[model samples]
Target: MFTGIIEETGTVTGVIRHADLWRISVAGPAVSADAAPGDSIAVDGVCVTVTAPPHDGVFIFDVSAETWRRTTMEEWRAGTRVNLERAVTPATRLGGHLVQGHVDARGSLTDRRESGAAAELTFCFPEKFRKYLAQKGAVAVDGVSLTVAKLTRDTFSVAVIPHTLGLTTLAEKKPGEPVNLEFDVIAKYTESLLQFRGTGERELSEDYFSERGF
Candidate 1:
């Protein structure tokens, strides 16, 4: 799990292609300072496990075919700048919303409006994800947690303050650029429960609650 608070920006140093997966090396000194093999890190909002120990602040990980198909990993190459965040620990502060580092879908920026140092970005995602989005709800874009400022039938807008712009990659984003998107996990769970209830397969009973100590 992660808090969607970007620790630092990393640069892709190498990309080795394999039949089923691609090995990627990223240079992030801050996030890779104490990272070890098997540790979880969020790279551009996707949960990738560390494959090897850090070497001079560089870490390696493999991206499977499924992950590439679901996210914007295909666009990654050497010199690519990516948002990086280490997995949250028990003592970690929840500075941002709960982020699983799981990308649900890929979206592209459709418009960008700047006012002084702030900016409002609009993106259009798949229609299926529309049900999970709500005005003022949480959304993670390229691993940066932001609140939805406006919602339309197919697009959503987020306001990026000057602080966030300097800390993350949002400031460099341009219209038509792809980004990884993860909607609020809580909303997805609630939708699943509602659908399950409507199925009438099995209803939650007092006995069930008692058994689980709920």
Candidate 2:
């Protein structure tokens, strides 16, 4: 798991395509400092395994066809900058919300408005994922954990502070650019548990808890 906290920005050095997967090499000295061949790294919010040990501050990852189809990895090319984060350890602080590094769906930036030194970016996401979003809820965009500052029928906005903008790739993003989005895992799990009511189970409600002596 990841904390959706970007450690640094990495540059894509090379991309080699094959029939089944594409080999991608990224240069991120900080994130790859102690990375091993099997370590999991979040490249722009997508969890990719290090295929080879770091060499000269470069790390290799293989993107499968399925991952490519569901993410913006296809748009990546040489010299592209991407947010990078290493997986969290047991002792690691939960700086941001829990992020699986699994891109649920791709979204696009719809608007950007400057707010003093910060900026609010609005993105339109898939309709299926709309139910999982709420005002002030946590969401990971391109692996940067942010809170929903506002919400609309088909869009949500996040406030990006100067620090986040300077450290990650959000500062370089423009309207209409595609972004990888990972909704809060807790929201998804809650929805899944509520769906169990369809299996002839009792509906979950305040009275259910009250009756249980809560």
Candidate 3:
């Protein structure tokens, strides 16, 4: 799991295509410091396994075809700046919301406006993901955990402070650019548990509804 706290922005140095996998090399000193083969690294919110040990502050990863279909990594090329985060450890401070580096979907930037030292960015995502959104809820966009400042029928917005803008790729994002999104995992789990309370095939329906007078 990750904390959605970007350690630093990394630059893509190489991308080599294979039959069913692509080998990507990224240069990040902090992220590669203790990284080893098979370690988990969140690259723009998608958990990718490190395929090779870090070499001169650069680490390599193998991206499978399925991962390509699920994330924006397919669009990555040399010189692309990506948010980087290492897997959280027990002793690590939870600086940001819990992030699994499992992207739920991709969204596009719809609008951007300045708010003094901060900037508000509006995004439009898949309608099916609307259930996971709520005002003041946490959302990870491109691996940066942010709070939902506003919500609409098909859109949501987050306020990005100047520090966040400077440390991550979010500042370079333009309208219509794709961004990977990971909804709060706790909310999804809550929704799943609530389903067992309703009239479904689940065994807890009878006992669950009786206590709540459903």
Candidate 4:
């Protein structure tokens, strides 16, 4: 798992297409410093395994046709700046919320405005994921954990600090750009459990709640 904390920004150096498969190379110093062939890396919030050991600060990953269909990978090209984060270790600090590096859905930047010294970016996401979002809740946008500053029926906004803007790709983001999104895993799990209550899989009812003193 990842912590939704961007360690560095990587640039797509190349994209080689072989039929429906794509082999992508990203060059980043910090993320590739100790990366191995089998290590997991979050590239723009999508967990991709390193195809081989780093070569001159670059790592390669293969994207299958199905992964391409489900993500914004089709929009990526050479020179695309992407957020990169290595998987978290047991001893690592939880600087951000737990991130599976699994993109639940894709969103697009709808608006951007300056809020004091921060940039407030509003994004329109899939309507089905709306129920998982709440004001001040955690959400991963392109692998960067951010709090929901505001929420609407199909949109949410986050205030990006100058530091965040400088260290990651958000500084170069513009309106209408596609972004990978991962909603809070806890919220999704809770919703699933509630939906399956008393189905013999597990009971989640008044008795269950009272037992837990909820």
Candidate 5:
């Protein structure tokens, strides 16, 4: 679990091809400070295991083919900036919404508008993901937690503050650029529980006791 708070803007140091997998190395100081082997790190919104512990704040990530297929990491180049975040701890402050370091899918940026002190970025709403999105909902794009400022049939916009622009890779995104997107996990869990409630072949209900074959 994570808070969707970006700790560092890590640079992609290496990209190695092994079969269909990619061994990536990212350089992040804050996140890699207490890093150890097998630790979880969110790189560009995807949770990757630490194959190599931090060496001078650099961490190595081992990514699978399916993970790359679901995210924009496959387009990463040397020096590409990515959002780096460590898992949330009990003592850590919840600065942002809950993020699971899981990318649901990739979306393309379609428009950008400037507000008084912020910028509103609109991205095309993926057909399958539309059901999960709504105005004022939480959405993690490329690992940055943002609120949906507005929603349309085919697009959703998010307001980006100055800090977000400077601290995360969202600043580098341009129109038509692809970004990794993760919907609020709570939404998925809630929908699952609601949809499957009492719909099983063997219906279970509070009105019927266990012995009554409810």
Candidate 6:
């Protein structure tokens, strides 16, 4: 799991495509400082395992066709900057919400502009995932955990601080750029429980509605 907090910026050194698989190499200093074979790393919010561990601050990961079909990494070429994060340990503080490093869906950047002190980034989520979004809810855009600032039928927005742009590949995002998105898993579970409740309209478990625990 990840915290959706970017640790370092890595640059693509090579992309080797071999039929159904592609091997990508990136150079990251902090994330690769103690890296080893079989470790997991988050490259632009997508969890990839280390096939060739960092040698001189470089790491390599193999991407299959399934991953290519689901993420923007297929569009990556040499010199592309990517967000990199090593998996957090049990002792690490949970600064951000739980991130599975699994990309649920891909979103396209529909609009971007400066909103006074911050940048307003709006991404259009497909209709299938629209139900998972809500105003002020959590959304992971390219590994960065951001709050949903606005919501529309097909679009949602987030306010990006200057530091966010500087620390991750989101700074490179422009119109039409595809980003990996993971909605809050808690929301999904909550909605499912609510739907089940609404079906039978079950009564309270205990004297729960006694006005502040009675």
Model 2 spans with C-alpha error above 4 angstroms: 201-214
Collision pairs in model 3: none
Estimate the TM-score of every prediction: 0.96, 0.92, 0.91, 0.92, 0.91, 0.86
Which 10 successive residues of model 1 have the least lDDT summed? 200-209
Question: What is the model-wide C-alpha lDDT for candidate 3?
Answer: 0.92
How would you encode candidate 2's per-residue C-alpha lDDT over 1-214 as one tens digit per residue? 9998899999999999999899999999999999999999999999999988899999999999999999999999999999999999999999999999999999999999998879999999988898889999999999999999899878999989999999999998999999999999999999898788778877889998899999
Candidate with better TM-score, 2 vs 5: 2
Q: After superposition, how far is residue 165 of candidate 1 from its true place, in Å?
A: 0.7
Which TM-score value belongs to model 3?
A: 0.91
Top TM-score prediction, candidate number: 1
Better of 1 and 3 by lDDT: 1
**Model 4 / residue 158 / CA error / Å:** 0.6
List the lowest-lDDT window of 10 residues for candidate 6: 203-212
Off by over 4 Å in 3: 197-214
Candidate 6 residue lDDT tens string, 1-214: 9988899889999999988999999999899899888999999889999987589899998988988889888889999998888898999888777887888888999999986656999999878888888899888888888889999998999999988888887777899988998888888888888887888766546664574476
Clashes of 5: 1
RMSD of each: 1.4, 4.0, 4.2, 3.8, 2.8, 5.4
Cα displacement (Å) at residue 93, model 4 = 0.8
Clash count, candidate 2: 0
lDDT of 3 by residue, 52-143 (tens): 87999999999889888888988999999999999999999998899999899989999999878779999999999999989999999999
Separate clash counts for every candidate: 0, 0, 0, 0, 1, 0
- Put down candidate 5 lDDT per residue, 1-214, tens digits, no spaces: 8888898899999999999889999989998999999899899889989987689888998888899888998899999999999988899998889999888989989988777667889998577778888789999998888999898877889999988888988777899899998998988988887777748644446754556765
Better of 4 and 5 by TM-score: 4
